[model samples]
Target: MSRDEHRHIPTLKRELAEGKITRRDFLRYSSLLGLSAAAAYKFAGDITGVKFIPTARADMPKGGTLRVSMRCPTIADPHIFQWVYDSNITRQVVEYLTLTGHDNVTRPGLLEGWEASDDLMTWTLRVRPELKWHSGRDFVAEDVAWNLNRVLDPNTGSSVLGLMKGYMMNDAGDGLWDANAIEVVDGKTVQLNIKVPQIAVPEHLFHYPLPMIDPDENGVFGVGSNGNGAFELVEYVQNGKATLVARDDYYGDGPYLDRIEFVDLGDDPSATLSALSSGQVQGSYEGTIAQIDIYRGMPGVSVHEATTAKTGVARGQVDQAPFDDPRVRRAMRVAIDPPRCLELAHANSGAPGEHHHVCPVHPDYAVLPAIQRDPEAAMALLAEAGHPDGIDVEIACKGDPPWELAAVQTMVEQWKEANIRVNINLLPSADFWDVWDKVPFGFTSWTHRPLGFMVLGLAYRSGVPWNESHYANPEFDAVLTQAEGTLDLEARRELIRQLEVIMQEDGPITQPLWRSVYSAWSDKVVNFAHHPTSYIFGNTLGLNA
Candidate 1:
C-alpha cells in the first residue's frame, strides 16, 4: 500500500469501531485509496466481526412509477441552481462527478476515482470510460472542465462560485478564475490545480447546485435533458409537475423505477400531507415535525427520519444599522434561548445549537461552552448600543416550511423581554426567495452539508453572494483558511475551535437547533428513505410487487 493509504487505514478502522461509519463506507473509501474491495471488507470484518454484503440488483424488482409530492421548480440552468427544489428536478436528469451517500462518505460518480497531491493542492480525476450522455454522445474530460469553468465564471452567478472562489480562483483580485486551473489532460483524465489546499473537494463536487451538465447544452439544462444520468426528463412544468423516464442505457446500477414524477402540491405542507394521505402521490418530499407525527399514526404510511445538520438561522445583516454594532449582535445572541426555541418550534425533536454554524455531526466540529440566554444582559447590551428605549426591527421569512415561521415566532416573543420589538413579515414562499438574502433581519432555512467549512464558506465568507449577514472579519477568515487546508483531524479541530469562538463572540446569526428531518411514503414504495441532505434519489427507488 502507498504511504498515504497506510495513514488512512487506522483512522478508517477507528471510525468503524466507534460506529461513526458503516462497513460499506469503509470499503468504498478504502477502494479509493487503492485498496482492493476484498481486502478492505476483510479488514473491516475482522475489526467488527460482521461481514458486509451488498444488495443485489435481483432483490430490487423494477418497473413502476413513483409519484412524489414536492414543490415544482422554475430554474433549469444546472450551473446556477439556488434551491434544493430546483436540483430535485434537474438531478434526475443530470449526474454529479461525485456522490456523497447517506453515510456521508463521498465516492466516485461520473469519475472512476481521483488522487490528490501530497500537499493536497492538486487533484487528478479519472473519468469513467464509455459513459454516454442522454443524447448518445460520449462523456469526456472536457465536459468536466467546461462545467467547472462555467461555475467559476463570475457572470454565471452560480451559487457554487461562493464555495469554490477562495480555493480554485485566481488571486488577481479581478474575480476571474485562472483559466489554466482546470485542465483536460486527456480523453479520460482531468486535473485541477487549486490556489489553496482544500480537503473537501470531493464533497463539494456533489453540492446540490453543482451537478454535471452536458457541455452541448450551452449552460441551460432541461431543454433537452441531455445528461449522463440514470433518467431522462420527459416533461417539466413550472409550479406544476415534472416527469422522468429511466434511461435503459444508464451507466450505473438499477434505476429500479421505470418512471418518476414530481408533482407540485404547492408550498403548503398541509397540501402535501393531504396528497400523501389521499394517495394522490406515493410520497411526500419532507415533513414538518407536526406532519411527521400525523404520518406516523396514519395507516399504510411509513416514515423515515434522519438527524441532520439542517437548521434555520435568525440573522441581522451586519452592514445595516443597529446590526452593524457588535453589541447589538451579541445582544441578539443572548436574548433568546435555543432550548426553548427547539421545544416550541420542533417539539424538542432536535439538539440545541451553540450559536455557531458548526454541528456535532461534522468530523472536525469543536465542542464549545453553551451560551446561556440572559434577557437582562441582552437589554443592557442593547442600551449600551444606544438603544436605551428598545430597538424595533422586522424579521422576514417564508410562510411555508412552517418550521422557519414557527421558530421566528418563538424568537419574536423571546426578544420582547430584551426590549427588542420585532415585527413579523411573513411572505409567500415564492416571494420570500426573491428577498431572502436581502432582508436586513431575516430567517432562512439551510439544508444539510457534510462539511462545516462548506456552508461557512458559502454563507459567511467575506464578499460572497450568500453572506446573508454581510459579516466580514479578517481574523475569522484567516482562521477558516487555515482550517480548510489542515488535513490532520486534531489540528483542524483546534483551528475550528478558534473559528467557533469568533462566531460566538461576534457572528451576526443565531442558529438555534440542528433538525431531525422526516419524510413519509406509502407501503407500496420500496427502498426509499429520507436522505439527510433531503435529496430525492429517485434512481434507487422502486415499487413493491
Candidate 2:
C-alpha cells in the first residue's frame, strides 16, 4: 500500500474480514496509505465491526433531511392528526394501524395481527408488544377504543364515520351503520364487534379519519391519548405547512430520516409545478399529472407513474324538472367527448374513464364499450324531453383551478351543437362546498374506495347524502346493496359490470375522466411512491444524502 489519498489495501482488508489485521497492522496500513487518525479510526471501526458502514453508491445516500413539495398548502387540522387527506403528503407524516397493497388488498400495520369469527362478525386484535405513541406513552388498547369512539361521535363529524358505518352490527338492519361496541380487555388486546359478520370490517378499520387520537385533554397531538408511530407531528400551521421529527423512542420500525416537513403549495397545480421546478421543495404530493415532464426530466429525478388513473367528474340532480327525464341526462352524457377532458381540462395526465366511477386500472372496473359522443342521439333525446330548441342549466363545482369555469365552458361549447347550454358559475373552494348545502347540480371527485365494488357507491347509492344529485333509483340502489356483501369476487365484479351498463343507460352522473398520479421529489429522498388513492409505504420511507 502506498501512502497517498487511497485506502485500497484497507478497503480490501475490510472486505476480506480476513484473518488477524491488528491495530499495528491497521496503523501501519494507515500510515502506508497516509490516513489521518480520524480516517484511521473509520478504517479500524469498519475492520472491527464497531461502527461499520456500507458504501452507498446509489440514489439512497444516507442521513439527510428530504425537502418535500405538495399541493394543498394546509391540510385540515383534524386531517393532520388523523390519517385523512386534504393532501397525499399526509401519509408520509403519519401512519395507521393497518395498510393495504397497491391492489387494494389488506395487511396489518400498527396492530401485529387480527382475527375474526367464521361469519367475520367479531374481530379480535393483537397489538404489537413494543408499541409506543409519538408522545412516549405506551400504545395500548385504550387508544384503539378511544379512536373508535371519537370518530363515531357525531360531534367530531369525521367523513370516515359515514363511510365506516356500514360495518357496525345491527338488528333487522337497524344499527348496521353505527358502532356496535369496542371492548378493550387490556392494554394490548381489543375485541371489536360489528352489527353482523362483514368481511370488509377489518379493511375499513384504517379508513381515513380513524387515526388514533389522545384521549386526555392535556391536548397533545398523537400523544399518549392517541397511539404511537415513527414520525410525530411536532408542529403544524393551518393552510401553511407541518414539521415532524423522528420519534427515536418509536416502538416498532422507524423513520430513518431526522425530520419531515410537509410544505403546502395550496391547490394550484401550476404553483406546485413551479415549486418543484424552482427547487422550492424536493418532492410534492399536490402536483397534478400535467407537470410530469417538468419534474421527471429534471437533472436528478425519477418518476413512477400509476397504471390506472383517478377519476374527476361532474354530477347533477335528476328529481328536478330539467334533469328528471333520463333523456335529458343521456343527452348531456352522450354529447360530451371523454378524451378531450384529459387534454384540454386535466392536462393530459389520465385517460377518459367510462360512465362508471371505477378506474380502468381498478381490478373490477367494468370493461363495457365506452359511451361514444353522439350529437345526433343527444339532439334526439333533447327533442323527446321537450327541449327541441335546447336546454340550459347551471353547475356547481369547487371552482379551484376554476374547475367549474373550464367544465362549463367546455360543456357549453360541446353541447351547443346538441341543443343544450350549460352556465358555469365558479365558486371559491369554501363557497363551492358551502353553497352545495343549498344547491345540488354540480361536479365532484368521488372518494377512492377499497374495491371496485365500493366505487359503485358514487352513482348507485345516494353517495354522501349531502351531495346526492337527487339521482336515485330503487333498483340501482338494491343491486349495489346486494353487491356489497356477496364476497364472491367474480359475482361482485359481474354485478358491478351490470351496474355500469345500467348507469350508462339510465343513471344521472356524468363521469368524464380518470386523472393520472403525479408527484415530485429530490434525489435526496428514496423509496417514494404515488399510491392509487390511500398512499401506503408512507412512514416506512427514508431520506438519503
Query: Candidate 2, residues 1-545: lDDT per residue as tens digits?
Result: 11234424445355336544454345333332223444555666666766634323344433556556533334443422222244344444445666554534455667776665545456677777787765567778987777676665545544444344445423232233444478887889888776543445545666654555556632234212233556655566655766766656665444567777767666566776676667776776534454666776777766656644456566677777687888888888899988786567776667775776766655446688878888989999999889888887887766454433565567668877887877777676656645553465677655456556554553345433333565666677666656655544456678788778778878777766766665566665666666666353434566654
lDDT of 1 by residue, 1-545 (tens): 22245356678778878877767656645554434455676788888898767655678878988899988867568777777878888887888988877767676788877777767677788888988887778889999988888787777877687677778766542454566789889998898888888777777889887888877778777645688888888888888989989888888887999988999988778888888889888998888887777999989999999988998999999989989998998898899899999998898887897878998877778899899999999999998999998899998988787878889998899899999899999999888888988999999888888777778888887766678788988888778877878766668889988889888989989888879888999989987778888888777888985
* Per-model C-alpha RMSD: 2.6, 14.4
Clashing pairs in 1: none
Clash counts for all predictions: 0, 21
Q: What is the lDDT of residue 319 in candidate 1?
A: 88
- Name the lDDT of candidate 1: 0.81
Instruction: Report the C-alpha displacement of residue 347, candidate 2, in angstroms.
Output: 5.8
lDDT, candidates in the order shown: 0.81, 0.59
Top candidate when judged by TM-score against the true structure: 1
lDDT of 2 at 314: 63
